[model samples]
Target: MSSSSLEYKLIKENNSTQGISIEGWKIVTKKLPILNSQEIEKVQKEILVPLPEMFFGNNSLSVSNDDYGVLFEFSPIDALKLVDSTKEGGEKVKVAYSEEWTLKSSKNHEHIKDVIKPYDWTYSTLYSGTLKIASKGQKFEKTTERIDIEKLKIPEPILFYDEIMLFEDELADNGTAVLSAKVRVMESGFFILQRFFLRVDDVLFKMNETRVYHEFGTKSLLKEYSSREEHYFKIKAQIPVYKGDDISQLTNPDWVSSKLTNSEELILENLNLLGGNYSKI
Candidate 1:
């Protein structure tokens, strides 16, 4: 599983795209500027949803194992599409300032040129990476398995790493919403994390995370998706006494995630990379 034994290749493009191919596995990341007006309009039309204030429509990250013929991709378009539109009542997120923003935009009546539309301003998404399988009879199955966090903490040297931001919005200045993905490769294997964080100043804080792990020379991979949320004041109370009013810790995703007591299990599954290698783990 060491780098010396693998055919590892790194491809870098002028447009800020990078790719790593090793041992029949490929990981690619693209970081581009925010979409122009025309690109935003096109995406809005196709997605039929309000684009975020700062939308990076061209950003994306993808990982695939040629041995299994499976590709997992993360993109702004696909991630935002999963956000609940105004029509979808289930798990709809509306912050305290949602009403204030809408009312202020309508105050001018007919004279106003544009009015703010009502949707999940927080941009909460349960996106756990899109999966595509090209090989027949190979698929992901539910399992009680979990990533070996203890193993990952064993201090192995990281061979490759990259982080990419998919999209973000200020939530009308009420708070912030951001979605990002990162990956790290090690001699034992690799790990991928896609996280979405939302914070509403006085209302709530939320996080949705997807973790994928693949051991070197293995024929399968494991993925776990989980969500955690808590009211704003409750998490704020967890801040250290000396750090009061600073609120810097609240902006940290890792800190806020650890304080979120309300937890939910969204998805737990494992995929067999090679055909007929379905022995349960």
Candidate 2:
């Protein structure tokens, strides 16, 4: 629990409202109802294959069969901490966790130009590309919109697993921008909360939003997080944080928000676990 050059501040209620900002911060929320790796892989390979098609909706985007072998792999470089809260519910779940996860993609793509051109960048925390914004008709030469990652009190922080599962998502979602963007574009950091096994007093529930970059990209595309406001977004599902006790519960309050209804069924089917059903499939 000793962090080098880490500063601590008690964020009060007044500070909670009006966008919580972090300098050089990345917020990772991991939803693990079926914490089994093989089940997760099955969801990624079988269930998610059709998502990009659903996400892009008619834009021509695909990988050559040969590209598949080279394009996907897992890495341990990604770190994890319990997200104090998240956008999983119609509102933030004060009781359970929200983990931050990203879809790992190899820079090599199907975009063949006789000679392939690779953008000399690996990861993006938030979509902070200045040139891409200009293409969208912005006034400034460069202005990065600071995303709001909630402020929380992390007791102890640690890496989630020895190795994080990395894979390519067929669909690339630019937040709410997914509703548009007809052409097939691979989404970075687009994720869903399938389900969770909750304990309000869970050891992993407390976490701090690490001071990190808006995203990882080309040297030019990497912009420092500025406090100025550019564009504002008001989501329909705006849930606030709450206070809670150290208690166990049978049902996750945010079960309705889960994309996977068969989490318990998958667990029982794969692992033959039949007793506990916090949010049983």
Candidate 3:
């Protein structure tokens, strides 16, 4: 209608990536469409990620450690089995993706990498979601160490991928008990670093670990991820922030903390994980 108004509209369109910003960052979320055969093939070649299974299963039990005030419950619906590298057609690997989880994108978003790797050359897929718990769940003691990599026998992961899982059942005896962030295997499954921040009840802790897949036991270093990973959970939520260009129904970190509640004292407690719990020498 007016000369100045029309000019502004054109400028906005040209700088499309400028997008809508929240906290000085663009946060755009777009709904995805179903994939045809060709599209599915493209996805497979890009990141032959294994089909992710439900996080919590029907047999979820509840347990707690009275001594440590810690708890454990919630059984995973289906364990994410290793990737099937054998391809008869040489086109696709064996993995199962439910129709619902098959398609979604977070393009033009800062919180999560949106683009598929190798094929896209732009972004990465970092998923975030919640694990629903029932009120009628059983309760017991966390008699054993919840995470004992040594206890369980693990087959060397043929797939090149990593996972970072964190849990904080409750703090101050009142908070959302949650298990968040277990990533599915991507096609470019090269070995790398993995870390997790775990909190059972009032206890807050951190874990830094790695599993290197030395190709053929002596593969050149050039073909792998960093042997040592220098990383902390960069995002405050450590879970998905279901605010912008994504739709996996993840927890939002609109506030300073998204651990269900924002408390200054609890934040200090987590410092223990970083050796902040120590006193000056």
| Backbone clashes under 3 angstroms, per model | 0, 21, 15
Question: Model 2: what TM-score?
Answer: 0.15
What digit string (tens of lDDT, one per residue) describes model 1 on residues 1-281?
A: 35465567776876688977877788889898999998988899877568888888898888887656778888889999888777442224433335533454466445322223455657888888887654546667898988998999998777689998888888666679999999987768889999999986666788999999999888778998999887677889989999857989989998998887746767888887765544321
lDDT of 3 by residue, 145-263 (tens): 12232422344422211222222222222112233322212122222222222221111222222222112222121111111111112333343556555522222222213333322
lDDT of 3 at 13: 27
For lDDT, candidate 1 versus 3, the one ahead is 1
Which rank order by lDDT, best down to worst?
1, 3, 2
Deviation in Å, model 2, residue 101 alpha carbon: 36
Question: Which prediction has more favorable TM-score, 2 or 3?
Answer: 3
Q: Which residue window of length 10 is worst by lDDT in model 2?
A: 177-186
lDDT of 2: 0.19
Q: What shift in Å separates residue 120 of candidate 3 from its native position after superposition? A: 44
